[model samples]
Target: MPPPEPGDVINYIYLFAHEAAAGRDEGVKERPVLVIASDAMGVAVVPITTKGEARSSRSDRIPDPVARAMGLPRAGESHVVVNDVNDFDWRGHDVIDLKTGSFLYGRCPPTYFQKIVRAVQASAALITDRR
Candidate 1:
């Protein structure tokens, strides 16, 4: 049970985001979202403080990091499917973002869905060592 490598932890940002977007738009496979890599790019620094770490940052902070890190546009502006890229999709757990509730991604009371999404995300790690 070693700690997740930087890349695995890094992708968690997208995993949560993709989960949120999926719930927001259940019918669509692609959904744009924002991210923040803790401004550690180019410095050769593996910051352990990405937005996904504390889940305290505002969801609005997403685009800045994604744009800076992956050259991706802000969420809602461009379309990216969670499964299409290296991102996660329908991992079985429903996703819930309390912070984004009714503010950025347009939702609420994430407690209900949070556990579901978490379970799904957790189950996703079953077959692959991606977790």
Candidate 2:
């Protein structure tokens, strides 16, 4: 499958700890990520976690309705870790099935997706000011 577009919610294998240590990421299970960009090389994404209490200034909570519309599991609340965005090579990674947890792509409504974009834009503005 092709890489998901920006604002798309996709299931991916995100081994963040490994990526930090070994300059590579290898995951054993599928995880949720919000695609920020997609190119021939791969996708730029930010990890989304279901741990609601983990929210901070760097993250934005995903509305429940939007989460369900995106086909995310009926887990607890979810949030996009906007500050931890990274680029992943599309060597063998892409979208995944939302229902059966199979390999396919999934997407959310544009209205809610805009919320994430605004959050990221705000974060980026702060970074620019800091620099």
Candidate 3:
């Protein structure tokens, strides 16, 4: 598979803030993650969650139409938690394929992606760089 690019959404075993704080190296669940940036060092991604209460003040909601366009599961509302990002190798073992036999759900629209980027820049969230 080709290297992941910004805007790509993929299922991954994303380590949550609480988990990492507790000294856990592995995430308990596999969920969707938005690729925010990538380079020779690794990739930076933010977790997407359907649980509204889990979202931080520095987050962006994915519109219903945009979520559908991105092929996200029709579960419910989704939000990208900009306050919590994870950095790991580009081809981390935590990355997983969807049921459809692919590692990607779809790409986030450029416009929406820009909004996310802006949020991230304004956020003081601590990045969990595990590279």
Candidate that would win on TM-score: 3
- What is the RMSD of candidate 2? 5.5
Off by over 4 Å in 1: 1-27, 32-60, 63-66, 75-131
lDDT of 1: 0.26
**C-alpha RMSD for every candidate:** 15.5, 5.5, 1.7
Global local distance difference test of model 2: 0.62
| TM-score of each model, in listed order | 0.19, 0.70, 0.91
Off by over 4 Å in 2: 17-29, 53-57, 93-101, 124-131
Writing each residue's lDDT as its tens digit, candidate 2 over 1-131 gives 56557767778765443344545445545778777777776776766777642323367677787777776665357777665555666645434456766543458688777777666666752211000
Locate the minimum summed-lDDT window of 10 residues in model 2. Answer: 122-131
Error of 1 at 63 (Å): 5.8
Error of 1 at 47 (Å): 20
> Could you give candidate 3's per-residue lDDT for residues 5-122 as a string of tens digits?
9998989999977678889999988988899998865889988888753623356678988887666785358888888889998688999988889889888989999999888888
By TM-score, the candidates rank as: 3, 2, 1
Residue-level lDDT for 20 in candidate 1 = 42
Evaluate model 3: give its TM-score. 0.91
Q: What's the ranking of the predictions by lDDT, best on top?
A: 3, 2, 1
Looking at model 2, how many pairs of residues clash?
4
